[model samples]
Target chain A: MPEGYLRQSPLASLGLAARAATAADAAGVTMGERERVMLVNLRGDGVDRGFLDRVRQALEVDLPAEPNTAAEGTRHRVLWLGPNEWLVVAGEGEQLAAALDAALAGLHVSVTDISDARAVIALSGAQARDVLAKGCPLDLHPRSFGPMRCAQSRLAKVAVLIDQRDDAPSYDLYVLRSQARYLWRWLDDAAREYAVRIIRP
Target chain B: MLLITCPFCGPRDESEFACGGEAHIVRPADPAALTDAQWADYLFMRKNVKGVHFERWMHSHGCRRWFNAARDTVTHQFLAFYKMGEQAPDIAPVSYTARPAPRTDPALPADPALHTDREGAR
Candidate 1:
């Protein structure tokens, strides 16, 4: 209630966003026609060596070998979110989470669907970096961070993945869906200094 | 900023992960059996190797797990990342490789109740 918090029913909001974007735009946002991504949460006491290999083979993307890193191909992107967990971004209908679970079926691991647990927002256009610079600390210089580069940092108070795409000066940000309205409002306010446009996809 | 590859979370911003220390140090199994000199060695000593060396890291903000990393002490380039129990993967032969695996053993007994505290700053 502090400032920008859009409090609409989840189902209603979902319908609105879906209606605005075509299927292709939704895919770019990792949401299907339904405007949702199948998020999977994985947990284990320690690193599961065999499971990691299987994930690599299943997603066909190299697991980032460094912290605060991400890797992407034409179809999918795998983000190192924590020591015991990761976030896999795929097309809206892609069964990345299920495939990962199947790959680690017998291993000592726990996987849960978190597709709805977080809110994802894709911010493109030239001013995206300027908007993010308000809260994030990472150097956004193209030379320092380019395609396939990502970082887990805070956007105001929310934990977010700031993934830079191939498009110059555009970025995709993921956070808790519950916090979407707050983040959107914050971003909109931040973008006031520059010419900004907001679209559902 | 330093780019750290968390064994669990993949590569993330250094801000999200915490650096533990040199990865290969083992704790003394029996504190009572060792001479004071040996106990001191276990407590305060570290090679702090230059160039490519193994170190311990935790994904404190995300998955909250600890893993091993091979990083160049000089360039601060991360060479390889592996989970907690497995040995750090062999560095690519072309660039820089770690010396033969140092005698890595659990220096301390596993604490059944010990869990990583995830609230601290990375």
Candidate 2:
């Protein structure tokens, strides 16, 4: 075994180094690879009242039934992926899947704890949309795909689930763990023109 | 480049979807009762109609749900997009082609890249 070695984060080496963004341009984008986030996947019949109710009871947040919409609670963010599938995101809520699994017992459902299967990347600032538009296909306009709206698409050939967070117009992108480094590189390169500022984890 | 109006996710770029050929092909209730030719016909016979077509499309990269769309093959205009179990609209082909319905974004103004509809149609 190595005497002095430490594990590295998905984007530890590749994240744009943190620096003071100059005021020359409209607030250059700031990006950070969010760590210690919990991601849970839920698959159940959304139309079933019982299923929806139990999920709400488990997470204390209602499941978003509308397509491409996100139900953002202070503690949890529920993103609708399909008629019967959703992704629940939070900050280090390790017991969420177990809670939901216990509560949803005896039903046709699946609650998987996928926190380790993916990494979260946050892109924020005035030029955030422009940075994402370099590879993502979704129309990232404020009017059409505004805040609270979420969509799953391929960003630079890597599948990502994007949530338009705020009018800072921040975006939360969830990518597979295996592709996190590559996607980070793609985003960093895309944001170069806008003078990206990397925030510390 | 087709801007598919997913019944669940609204209109999204065609890049987010995968077109499955020929919707509404049901399996026979009793395959044992069918003749060999009938089984073959059921498996391989899909209308290669050049005009209006009914096909299945999955929002593979988005909601991951599938829906039916009735669209003109030649003009590349979408007539209707409905849920999985819903029936196709009753507009005649004459009206469907004479004045093709505009492709609504289902959310906002159109994106210019969605004009070409014939992708994955080899």
TM-score of 2: 0.84
Judge candidate 1 at residue A62 and give its lDDT.
64
- lDDT (10s digit) by residue, model 2, range B48-85: 87777899999898888889999888878899999888
Best by lDDT: 2
Model 1, span B15-54: residue lDDT tens: 7778889887777777899999988888888876667788
> Residue B103 in model 2: shift from native, Å?
27
As a whole number from 0 to 100, the lDDT of residue B20 in candidate 2 is 94
Worst 10 residues of 1 chain B by lDDT: B113-122
When candidate 1 is compared with the true two-chain complex, its DockQ is 0.21
Residue A70 deviation, candidate 1, in Å?
2.1
Flag regions of model 1 displaced more than 4 Å: A1-34, A42-49, B1-122
Docking class of 2: medium
